[model samples]
Target: MPDVACPESPVTPPPPDTHTRSLSRTLPISVLLFTVVPLVIAGLLTLTEGAQRLREEQELRARQTASLLAGRVTQLLASAQRLGQAMAVSPAVLAALQPPASADRAMDEPPSRPEVLGDPWLALIRSFPEVDRVELLDAQGRKVYTHPPRMQESPPVRHLTASQPPWYPREDLGSIEIGLRVTHDGADGWVVVGVSAQSLARALEPPAQDGGELWALLRDAQGRVLMLVRRIAGQPPEVQPLPVIEALAAPDARSRPVVARSALDDSAWSVEVQASLDAYRSLVLAELLRFGLTVLVISALSAGLAWHFARSLTRAIREVARAARAILRGHYLNAHVALQRDDELGLLAQSFNHMSRQLEQRERERDVFGRLVSPEVRDQLVQGELMLGGQEVEVTVLFSDIRGFTRLCEGLKPRDVVLTLNEYFTRMTHAVQRFGGYVNNYMGDAMVVVFGAPTPDPHRVERALHAAVAMRRELAAFNQERASYGAAPLEIGIGLASGTALAGQIGSPERCIYTVIGDTVNIAARLEGLAKHESGMQVFMNQATRDLLPPHLREALQPLGELALKGRGTRVPVWGLPEGAELPEPPAHLRRPEEEIL
Candidate 1:
């Protein structure tokens, strides 16, 4: 074919084979989305529901077990009470409560073998498997007779008068005495019974394979646990009282009636049950297996679907990723991804554009904030600036107040007063900053500044004194300037003190201000007040600041010896500087004992 002259046109490459590999990638992604995702979600739900059900079942089982065990203990307690009541009615026990015929015999005298009441009582107690020991006490709480004399002296018995009945405290078998009123039986003494805790423990033993543990305790109204028995073989029998559990026991309706009480003595007894969680271990294992199988099946299906869906999703994601990389490289306006779908992908593009705008806005705001606060301070705030703790630091605090700001404001327009004050602050702030002090805050016409904060300066006291002097001098110069303008000269009183203070940002997390709190700041404020009180001085330095300065500098300054300050118990030595004196060197110590100076 003859070559024909063709119109000039750019050769366009065939549509970059968009469909050639599209199906290849889309198929796997579709399979993953349809199969694996649903399976995984189903498995998670199954596992969660199964675990919850297992917990509920275990809790219900525990409650049931505790109730049953508590019932058994209740029965045993009731039996013990019945036995005690029967003993009260026994003629022999009643006879034992009477004083012996030979009242002349010493209380400790052993009853003649034939006359002793303990032998018969011992015989009777032995007949009952639960009675470990029995004893008799006289009105004086002395053990007149015991089945077995285990010790040289019975542990001191708590005296039980006619008003108090003889009954065992349910918690322990420790030496307990209860009075049996002789009046009821036509006698003039009391009888005490001591039962062995071991016998009670044996009596209250629970069934062997009951799947729960049971404990029996005897307590006084005070809720002391005197005896405890556990169903578990290897567990030690506990005799110590459980106050917390006992408190709960009394308040709970289900537990109150079952917890026994002795009618004769008014002593209380209780039982506790704790079901073993292991009781339902088999059920849990079975449910767990079912959960695991369901999870495995669902996970397999979900993963497959996810893998297939991921392939198609990756195409749109890759486009966004490529544009993001371009934007990160500083091509802010040169890069954008085409999000053709009206789904999450399109929303993401919109969000990304919004994020770009927000990021620019933040940059501008940061610049403005930097101007408002010092760069270092702004950085600290933005970067979690502090450890949120206070520290004792050597700081020089300065308090300055306009001498007659309120009076001056009355004469001038409000705007004029504000303008003049603003001008004053500008000059004072510049001076303070020059001396490496931070203006802590402005309180109406007063300004508080701290040296050696945020960052410490070794010569903080000297710097603060220098700043205070400079501030007064600047005020004079400002007043002179105002005088030329036909305005009254402004005067300010300044106070400076140096000492240890707790300095840090103080307030809530949402709003906080850096400040110092301590006796030093208070003293500085007091000195400022004193400045107004002093005859010819506008600045007052407390003994603290005066002592901090060198002796030569101290000599140059005029001392206002021992002036009493408000709220101070004793007079404080104060000093003032002449209108013009060279700045003094800081003393080694702000305070020294009078003897040391001598």
Candidate 2:
């Protein structure tokens, strides 16, 4: 079969994109530190700390106001009880309760006459104006006489035993009933006074600025709402049975209620002072207004200070940002921030300048290095895949020489010589890199390349062989272009050998380089020299490389009779690949290793 270029493998995969520019613009760091961060923090503190403090103050003031109102109600009830105690033992009250001469006389009273039953009790009630009505009960709990009787008949107060004289608050009558026992010479009786609810409200009100009108409730031990002061018009004449007055109000919309237990002897009643939350609401509003003002003042001052500090940083930072934008556009410029201060911003600017210089140096080195090695090898070295120390590994060595270059250069100008070699070497280098081969060194007019050093390739032999063939073919086209430029066409000889080799960083620490070295490399160099002398061919492959080629392309090689080389002890099988030729393979033979031309 005629010599043909190997089928093109998939193009070498590019390294992944690790970093990219953000598409959306964001707030600058200065703004974040100065205005935004402080605002957010202040708002959060105002909501949490300010609100909590206001709520706590409201709760405390409500409790204090409730206690004051409770004390007032207790005082009112205590005074009424004192009057009842005095009236209980009065001679008039005692005489009035005694068995009368006739039942008709006891009941006899002109309908038009409304005089006090007796002056001793009347005078006492007049003195204590809160005591609206008074009644003297017989030992059997029957009403004997009542001053200004509300009803023709009234039921006895329950929840009061003979052994205990109880203070009862009646919800149905809207009054407080105080019961006191009389024990003079064993003639026992009970004096009960019904103090009006209207008088109780007057006594329950606190100081004008303290809070709203205090509505007081007297409850028994059973948590019942027994009496409500000011139960007159538009008020519920009776308090319903419930655990607390809140049960009567809509949920979360009731007055703040403060309570105090009765100081009376029986201790059966309690006074609750219920008032609106308007006073506490006012207090909270005033506190919040002050807090808001403080926040505004502090925020303004903080922002100004923050900007002062941030301005120093932002100058350097903005320069860095602009420099980065230039780098993204392929202009590797430095920030060059000339901050004179010995602060972090100054250090940052210095670091940026140093990095920019490093990047500029690396760009030159990368271009020189990449021309010699595939990007895959570059990435492998960068990622530390190949350690600095040497390791034994199999690799393919390809050596190519510019044929007739020494003679061709003698007739050309010095500038032409360099331009020709540069163009020729560049084209050939590209061919090798396409097949994962790297140009390791340039020996005058000759080029030395290696396959699978930094990154080991299992198919190194075939790749080297393919790259050699590609280089041979690309040279023909390059020659045509050179002829058009009024320059002589170019030609080169390639020799490939593959075997176990020592491959790693090969030089001193100051200028270390990754390379491959062994007899395999030596043999490849010898093969190229032999191509110039004996057969003067375009490409040649040693036995080691020939064995690895695919069987179909192996037929493309033509066997030239074995020739003794300069140094080794054996004669080796050799094959030739002249460009555009159809060559038939020779029968297999295991020739002894000889100097293929040492």
Candidate 3:
């Protein structure tokens, strides 16, 4: 029979069959997309919406401020024009600008207008501290009767050629002016009030809290830049002049990519809240940056989850694979994977472990049965070819006993006796297995060994005799080892018998043993027992065993005369080891019952 061997390493399982399949293919892509995509998309959308809303809000505030300033300026200019009209019609102006006694004032009747009008116009200019350099001009454009008489020392202004009755008088002192035609008897007189351009600019200055990125340009009706304020990032916003013109003309030209502008109708001026396109672009870019960062964070979290999920899933798969490979190699001992979750993967692992346990148990049972009955018997049974019932087959049986065992036990402790028996049996059992025989059972101090039951053996007798010789030689070496321990040397007797015998599994259903039975078995036992009677011989066989042995082994046997065996119908020819000077003699004190009977 061929030697049976099994493999046992997990570091290398059988290489998996070549295939294109992999975890990437098996794992779902939709799970990754669903887990990550929505968060990124939602962040982008929210950012975009917020940016747009903020832009509109900022633009609205700019327009509102411009409109508010426009209304206030328009009211200021109109009120100043009304003040000029009131001053131009004053009776004090008629007396002060005309000669000390003029004909137009009519040397008649104490003049139609008052000569000293209590200087109410100077009081009006004084009341508005913000107004600087207000002037009262005569029809000739000269400072006439100026308040505090200080204006009379200034150089004369050129005469006005444009003042007329129901007059629209024109005054250009290089300042924003609101003048009413000053009429006495429907004649034109000059009453001009000047508003300082620097003062106007200062009055229109927006609060410093407005961010530095904002620039406000106040352009007059002629599209001249009166004031500009840049409150953020330290650069004045550049704006085209034509947009302001369009603003002044249409009072509705709202152009883009130029400035966030509101035209002031009352002043015929455009309050252009100047900004560059980059401002809105910057907002959009900021939103995009925020979106990119959010995407990175979401992607990282999603990747972590994916990795954890994949690791957990593959761990179970690898465990099952390893256990499966072990089973394939016929090494199913303790082949179970453990998982502690309540998910579906855990259930799958549980089922796999259950299957692994079943296989492991089956492997254990078969291994135990193989050791008990021999591999040959196990193979036959596993193949379903062997019948349970007994069958007669020619077989050779050997029985052995430790010689002088009862005497040896008397000299040693119980533990030493058992140890010696175990060592002796181990050596002898190896001898039988080497010669293709199975040890069926061990009696105290003896072993029953057999050849050719689960397997056929043409050389059964030779093999059995050889095993006996081998065992005796092995025991000699074992005795040498024992001697080193100051232990008494041990010896054994062997007996062989060859004949047809009944061989099969025998006993109750719950417990059974594959063994041989019949006269051949009993005779083998009787031969071993006879060793005690026949001068404590080392080996003995019956005539039947001797006839079957090969010539060499046959020549090695020496005959003893036919003897009556207990429970036998007739005398049987018995055999013993060849006579030689080297053959051992029995110890003197121990002998057989038969010798005493004789």
TM-score, every prediction: 0.40, 0.46, 0.43
Residue-by-residue lDDT tens digits, candidate 2, 435-522: 6676677778888888877567877776776778778778889988878868777667788888888877665544466667788888
Each model's total of backbone clashes: 30, 2, 3
**Residue 496 of model 2, lDDT score:** 81
- List pairs with backbone clashes in candidate 3: 212-231, 212-232, 213-232
Predicted structure 2: clash tally:
2
lDDT of 2: 0.63
Taking the tens digit of each residue's C-alpha lDDT, what string does model 1 give over 458-500?
Answer: 7776777777777877887898999898988877788888889
Give a tens-digit lDDT track for model 3, residues 1-598.
1222322213323323443445434344444664566676788778768776866776676777677666655665666666667767777665554543465643332322222447566677677644454455555565544434444344556354553221121232214654444557543446656565555555455444333345566666666665554445444333324334344322222223334566655335766664333445666787788778877777777886776776666666677677778778876665666667686656656776666666676667676666666667777766655555678999989988877889878867889788777777778877677777777777788788888776788777777776777777788898899889788887666788889899876654444566788899999988887866777456788998888865655665677989887778898999887524142232232222322210
Runs in model 2 lying further than 4 Å from the true structure:
1-39, 45-317, 323-333, 342-344, 354-389, 505-514, 529-538, 558-566, 581-598
CA lDDT of every candidate: 0.61, 0.63, 0.63
Q: Could you tell me how far off, in angstroms, the CA of residue 181 lies in candidate 3 after the best superposition?
A: 99
Q: RMSD for each model, in Å, please?
A: 19.2, 23.0, 35.6
User: In model 1, where is the ten-residue run with the lowest total lDDT?
Assistant: 1-10
Q: Scored by Cα lDDT, where does model 1 land? A: 0.61
Candidate 1 local Cα displacement, residue 501, angstroms: 33
- The alpha-carbon deviation from the true structure for residue 143 of candidate 2, after best TM-score superposition, in angstroms, is 74
How many residue pairs in model 1 have overlapping backbones? 30
